[model samples]
Target: MRNVKVIVQGGPANEEVRTLPAHKKNPEVGDKKTVFSSHLLMEQADAESFGDNEEITAMDWGNAFVRNKKTNPATGKIESLDLELHLEGDFKKTSKKVHWLSAPTDAHPLIPVVLIDYDYLINKKKIEDGDDFTACLNPVTEYRVNALADANVEHLKRFDIIQFERKGFYICQGTKDAEGRMEFGFIPE
Candidate 1:
């Protein structure tokens, strides 16, 4: 197993921190990135319609990585520790830069999941109009404009590939409601 590099969030906003240049590249790959961080605002995509790739577009999907390490109960040994999740797919359309799920591949590290919910609340308060939306995966989720019974169901139909439950995929779309604000949501299919 490869050594896993972890970047634990540190200190206060005012705290000074030092860093090495190599791991701080423009497109952080492997274990060098953070999820749901301020970087989310860096890639501002044009708001998309419901059930689209808004969240996907904002993400550095190509380089996204998940660490998988599990212990075997039989021998009480940890297996596959520091295993950086990987995807294997055909070179075909690789030039187009498709995600591992869409591309033809025997290695499917990210499986398509279902959309379980849309939005719940923040600090015991419901977001009145526009706020960043979140999802609960089953792997699945949805929104007001996005009904789980609608597009949510269809995205789970993995006709072309075998979607392993071990991994998951998230698709998000952000758009303005009748009242304008930055409202975003996570989609599970």
Candidate 2:
């Protein structure tokens, strides 16, 4: 049970909103989670930024409900509300430092990326050009590039969530994809 406050400016913006309860639990497998939320304050100029064929990046704000709150019919009492929290944008343009992969060669330039997942965190050495990586719907809160390389995987297993600095908060999906890749998602905060 954590509390989060969010504010957005320079776009379809809103005044500061406060005291929202973040109570939703992370969603399980096969769940269609709402990964992004916020009051979209799109101005004509902002809308126009998305020119016919180009991709435009923008910061978005919204609340994330990890799980839905439901009441027990028999007890006539509210059981638990789904985990929810405030989320702010963490995309490359809005982030203070953009994340990129160093070129395989020492002299080549680096390449920028929009999303990264657990596989990148666990096995940075094995990532190849065609490897598919996936992240949780929620953003991660904290992470280090070589966490597993330095620590015991079993010891870190107890925590359900991890914060990826400059990335976002992530919750483990506890499942693997068709290619046996670990799947996780982020909830921006």
Candidate 3:
């Protein structure tokens, strides 16, 4: 299986961040000689959006390594571990970038949030003069996804607009409730 790389956000402010330097001579070897972290924290969710897909390089002393499982041929049981070199610069050729949210902790509690999206009220994009608009109305118009936002989301007020990375912009539906959960409606691009 190919390894996966993730860009993590939304956790404690004091969390560890690492950087690595790309090889100077060969621009293709790394990330165009751009300086970035060699050590990246491997994050997991309470319920992973994808299973066994995020196990790429794991966190350790300044070096990123992928764990390759060795299994016995006779019994098919796992036998040993093999480590493979995976650097931040190697992302161009082998890595798939996935976005993740770090788990909530007491130091940086996450704000519960619901993101709602809507289908077109009228299915047709443009209606001709003789077309019946009511017949084209969409019955199911809303889709909601429960998510956790960074602690800073507490500062958001009703009707405030915020951009969710890779998810587009959202408008705050209302203020946080007693349980510290709020709702946002997706704004189409």
The TM-scores of all predictions, comma-separated, are 0.16, 0.22, 0.51
Task: List model 2 lDDT by residue over 1-189, tens digit each.
Answer: 111221122322222323212323533322221122222222222232232322233322332322332345895444333222324433343212211111122322212112234322443455566666543222453432211110111122322665433446766555544544344456555
Q: What's model 2's TM-score?
A: 0.22
Q: Which residue segments of model 1 deviate by more than 4 Å?
A: 1-10, 13-174, 178-185
Q: Which candidate comes out best when scored by TM-score?
A: 3
Q: Model 3, 69-174: lDDT tens per residue?
A: 4445996544333333344434434343443333444654556888889987988888889888788889889887767665555767888777664578899987
Q: Count the backbone clashes (under 3 Å) in each candidate.
A: 11, 37, 6
Every candidate's CA RMSD? 20.0, 21.5, 10.6
lDDT order of candidates, top first: 3, 2, 1
Best by the lDDT measure: 3
Q: Write the per-residue lDDT of candidate 1 for residues 99-178, one digit (tens) a residue.
A: 11111123212222232235434333454455544432123223333211111223322222221112233333233345
Q: What is the lDDT of candidate 1?
A: 0.25
Ranking by TM-score: 3, 2, 1
lDDT of 2 at 118: 37
